[model samples]
Target: MNRSSECITKDSSRLITTELKPPDISLVQEKSWNAAVQMFGSFLLAGFGMVAASLVLDVVQHWPVYEQVSEVYILVPALLGLKGNLEMTLASRLSTHAHLGHLENCLSTITLGNLCLVQCQAILVGFLAAMAAVAMGWIPSGEFDIHHAMLLCASSVLTASVASFVLGVIMIGVIVISKKLNINPDNIATPIAASLGDLTTLALLSWIATLLYRSIGTNILLPAIIIIIGAVLVPVCGYAAWKNKFTKQALDEGWVPVVSAMVISSAGGLILDFTVSNYKGIAVFQLVINGIGGNMAAVHASRLSTTLHTGQLEGPVISATTKLLLLMVVPGQLVFIYTIGYLKAGHTSLTPIFMLIYLSAALLQVFLLLIISHYMVVWMWKLGIDPDNSAIPYLTALGDLLGTALLGVAFHILYAIGDKDSDLGD
Candidate 1:
C-alpha cells in the first residue's frame, strides 16, 4: 500500500524466470487416476497411524492422571495445532496472493511492515485467548497453576511468532519453488500446511514443554518475557532489511530475503527455547489462541482480497459464500477439535457427545462458510479480481475457528435440553 510496495508490484513481473523447471512426475507430480488411488491409500494409512498413537497413549499412561496433567499440558497440542493451522493458513493465503500477483512485492517495505504489525497483534491476541481458555475450564484445573499457565502462554507467543516469521519465508519460497518445479504454489500451500501443522507441531510442542517444565517450574516469568521481547525484535530487523537498498532489488530478483527471514526465525526460536527447561506445565496452550488469530487473519484477508477489486457492495459477500461452501462445508477439520477435547480430557465416552454436537454444529457452520464464500465470489467478480485458490484456505481456517465456537454452543444447548420429557426424546 506504500510507495515501496507499489514499486515492487510494478516490477513484480521481472521476478518470473525465463527458465522454468520441467514437470516431474514424482513428489511435485500432478495427479492422475493412479495417483488418486495412491493418495487415498496413504490417507488410509495415516488414519491408522493416528489410531495407533491414541491407543499407545491410552494404554501406557494412567489415563486419568495423564488427562489431569494434560489439562495443563493439553494446551500445547491444541495450541500447536492452532499455530500450525495459522501459520499454514497465512502461508497458503500469501501463496495465493503471489499467484494472483497481489504479492508482487514480497520484499517491499510495506509488506514487511504489515506482517510485523500482524505478528504483534497475533501474539497479543494469542496471550489473551490463552487466559480465556484457562478461565473457561479449558486448562487442567488444580494440576496446573497461574504461573505455569502464564509461562506457557508467554512461551507460546514467543515460539509461535518465531514459527510464523519462518512461515513467511517458507511461503515466499513456495512461490519460487513452485515456479522452479512448474507447479502452482497456490495449490500446494494449503493442504501441505495443514498436514505439516499436524505432524511437526507435536514434536516441537513436546520439546518445549518437557524442557521448560523440568527446570524453572513455571516461575521463569522474567526470562519468558525477555525472550518474547527479543523475539519480537526479530521482526523489527526484518522490517529494516526490507528497507535496505541493497536487498531491495533482491525482492524482484531472487530468494535472499525469504531465506533470511526463515534463518532468523528458526535461530531466534532456538535461542528463546533455551529456557524451555524453566517451563512449568502445558506451555503450548498459547498456540491455540494464536492459531485462532491466524485463522481470523487469513479468512478476513482472503475475504478482503476478493472485495478489493469489486465495484459493488455484493461482490465480496458472494465470493465469501462460495469459498465457505467449497472448503469448510466439505472436508473441514472437525475431527481435530473433538480429538483435542477428548484426548485432553481423557473422556473417550465424551468424544461421542462431542461428535454429536460437532456434527450438528457443522451443519450450521457449512451454511455460514457458504454464505461468506458466496459473498466473496460475487464481490470479486464485481471488483474484477481473479478469485480462486486464495479464498478456500482462508474460509476453511475461519470455519474451523467459528465452528469451534458453534460446537461449544451446541454442546451447551444440548446439555441444557437433555432428558426433557418431550416427543423428540424417550
Candidate 2:
C-alpha cells in the first residue's frame, strides 16, 4: 500500500507540473503578442510619418533654397538630429515621469519645468548645430561668406526654436492622451516626436531658410536680428529651468549626450553630403533607415528606462523587449523600401540586389543599436543616471551614424558591382 501511494503521489505531482507549464508558456506568448500589437502599430504610424517627411525632403531637395544654399544639405541631418535629441528626450523623460506616476497632473510643475528645459536646450543646440553645419559646409572649401553664414545660422536656430516649441506641445499632448487612454507612452511618444520632428523641423528649416536667404545682403539684418532674439531667450529659458526644483537636475545632466549626439549627427551629415549626390534615392532612403532605426532604439530605451524606474529590470525585460524590437526591423523596412521604390520609380531601380543590400544594412544597424540601447539603459540605471534623458540621445545619434555609414557602404557596394543606378535627382 505504501509503494502504491507513493507512485500515485508522484504521478499527481507530474500532472500538476504539466498543467502549470502551458499557462506559463501561454502567458509569455500572450504578453509578447500584445507588445507586438502595441509596438508595431505605433512604429508603423511613426514610419509613415517619416515617409511623409522624406517625401517632403525629396521635394525640398528641388527647391530654389536647397539649390542656391548648398549648405542646407549639411544642415539637414544636424538640425533633424538636434530635433531628435531634444524632443525625443523630452518624450522619453515625460514617459518616464508618467510611468512613475509623477505626471498624474499633466500640467504639473515637473511637466512645465521639463518643457522649459527642452526649449532652453533647443535654442542652444539649434544654434550650435547651425554653427557646426556652417563650419562643416565651408571649412572644406576654405570659403566663408558671412552672408551665407548668417542665412544658415538664422534658419537653423529659428527652425530649432520653432520646431521644438511646436513639437514640445505635441509631445505633452500625446503623453497626456496616451495616459488617459491607458496606453504606454513609451511605445508611441518617442516615435511621434520623431515623426513630427522630421516633418516639422524640415518644413520650418526650408521655409525659414528661404526667407532668411532672401534677406541676405538686403540691409534686412533679419538674420542678425533673429539671432539676437534667440540669444536673448536662451538665458531667459535657462533661468526658468534653473528656478524650477523639478528641472534643475536636467541642467546639470544631459548636456554630454545632447552635444555629443549633435557632433555624431554632423558626421553623418558629412557622409550624406558626400554620398547623396552619388546615389539615386539616397536622401530618401537615409531618412527611412535612420528614422526607423532611431525610433526603434528610442522605444526600447524608453521602455527599459520605465522598467528600471519601476524596479522591474530583470532578465525577461532584457530579452523580451530586445527581441520584439529586432523582429520589427524586417517588416518595417519592407514597407519603407517599397514606398521609396514606388516614389522614386524612375530615379531608383528596385533591383533584388539593391533591396537585399538595403534590408541587410538596416537590419544590422537596428540590431546593433537595439543591443547598445539595452546595455546603455542598464548601465545608466546602475550608475544612478536617468536613462530617459541620456540614453535616447546617445542611441539615436549612434543610429544616425550607423545608418548613414551603412547606407553609404551599400551604395558603394552596388557601384563596385557595376550596378550603375541613377544618381539622386535624376
Candidate 3:
C-alpha cells in the first residue's frame, strides 16, 4: 500500500510540473505569426493602393505640358521620395511614441512639434530636390535653364507644403485608429503614409506644375515671390526646429536619414531620366515596383524599430520576428507581381519573359532590403541610436536604388534571352 501511494504521488508531481511549465515558446510563435499577418496584410493593401495611384502617372506622362518639359520626369522620383521620406519618418516617430506609451489621445506637444518639423523639412527638401533634379537634368539633356529650374522648385515647394499638411493629418488619424482597434500602429502607419504620400504628391505635382506653367508667363512676379517666401520660410523654420527643445530632436535625428534618402532618391531620378525613353511603355510598372518595394521596407523598418524599443526584439539576430517578416515577404511579392502583370498586361502586351524578369527583380529587391534592414536596425540600436529615426528613411531610399538597378538588369536579361531565342528559331 505504501509503494502504491509513492507511485501515485510521483505521477501527480510529474503532472504538476508539466502544467507549471510556461508555454512561452508556442505563445511567442503565435504572436509573431499574428504580427506578421497584420504587417503583410497592411502593406499588401497599401501597395495595391499605390498601384492605382501609379496609373495616374501613366496619364501624366501623356500630358502635353509634361512632354514639353522633359526635365519634369527627372524631378518626379525625387519629389515623390521626399514626400514619402517626410511622412514615413513622421509615422516612425509617432509609432515609437505610441510603443513607448507617450502618445496621448489629443495632439501632444511632441506631436505638434513633429508636425512643424515635417512641414519645415518638406518645404526645405522640396527646394533641394528641385535643385538636384535640375543639376541632374543638365548633365544629360543640357536643356533646362533658370526658368525651368525655378518653375520646378516653386512647384515642388508649393505642392509639398500643401500635401504635407493634408497627409500629416491623415497619418495622425491612422495612428489614432490603430490604437483604438488594438492594432500596432508600427505595422500600418508607415505603409499607409507612404502610399498616400505618393498619390498626393504626384497629383499635387501635376496640378501645381500646370498651374505654375500657365501663370509663369502672365504673372512672373508670383513665381519670384513664391521662391522668396520659400527661401525665407526655410531658414525661419530651421531656426524654430533648432531653438525649440521639443522640435530640435527631430531636426537632429532626422537630418541624416532624410538627406541620405534624398541623395539615393536623386540617383533613382537619374535612372528614370536615362531610361524614360527606353522604358516609356513600362513607366507605370517601374513606379509601382519602386513604390511598393520602398513601402514594404518602410513597414519592416517601422516594426523592427518599435520592437527594438519595446524590448520585444533584443538584437538583430534572426529572432521569431525576423523570421516572420522574412516569410511574409514571399507571399507579398508573389501577390504584387502576379496582380501587376494581370492588370498591366491589359494595357500593354506582357510576354512571359518580361513577367519573369519583373518577378525576379522584385523578389531580389525585397530580399536585399530585408537583409539590409536587419543589420542596420541592429547596428543603430547597438550604438544607442534610435532606429525609428534612421531606419525607415534609409531602407526606403535604398529600396529605390536597388529597385531601379534590379529593374534595369532585368530588362537587359529579358532582351538577351529574347535575342537568344530568336537566333535559335532562325
The top-ranked prediction according to lDDT is: 2
Taking all chains together, the TM-score of candidate 2 against the true structure is: 0.84
In model 2, the Cα lDDT at residue 288 comes to 82
lDDT of 1 by residue, 1-426 (tens): 344334333332221221122212232233444333322333333333333434443443444333433433445434544454355435544544454344444435434643553354345434543554465454344454655565456555655565556655665666557656655443345444444444444444444544555556545666366456856764575455455432333222222222232333334234324322322111221122223223333334443442332222434343432343333322333444444445552222234554565455655665565566556545544443333323443454455455545544553465465612221111
User: How many residue pairs clash in model 2?
Assistant: 0
Error at 408, model 2, angstroms: 4.4
Report how far off residue 52 is in candidate 3 (Å). Answer: 2.3
Candidates 2 and 3, the one with greater TM-score: 2
TM-score of each: 0.49, 0.84, 0.81
Error of 2 at 106 (Å): 6.3
Clashing pairs in 3: none
Considering lDDT, which of the candidate structures 1 and 2 is the better prediction for this target?
A: 2
Could you tell which candidate, 1 or 3, scores higher by TM-score? Answer: 3
Candidate 1 regions with alpha-carbon error over 4 angstroms: 1-71, 77-85, 100-122, 133-146, 217-222, 225-368, 376-398, 401-426
Q: In order, what lDDT does every prediction score?
A: 0.42, 0.77, 0.71
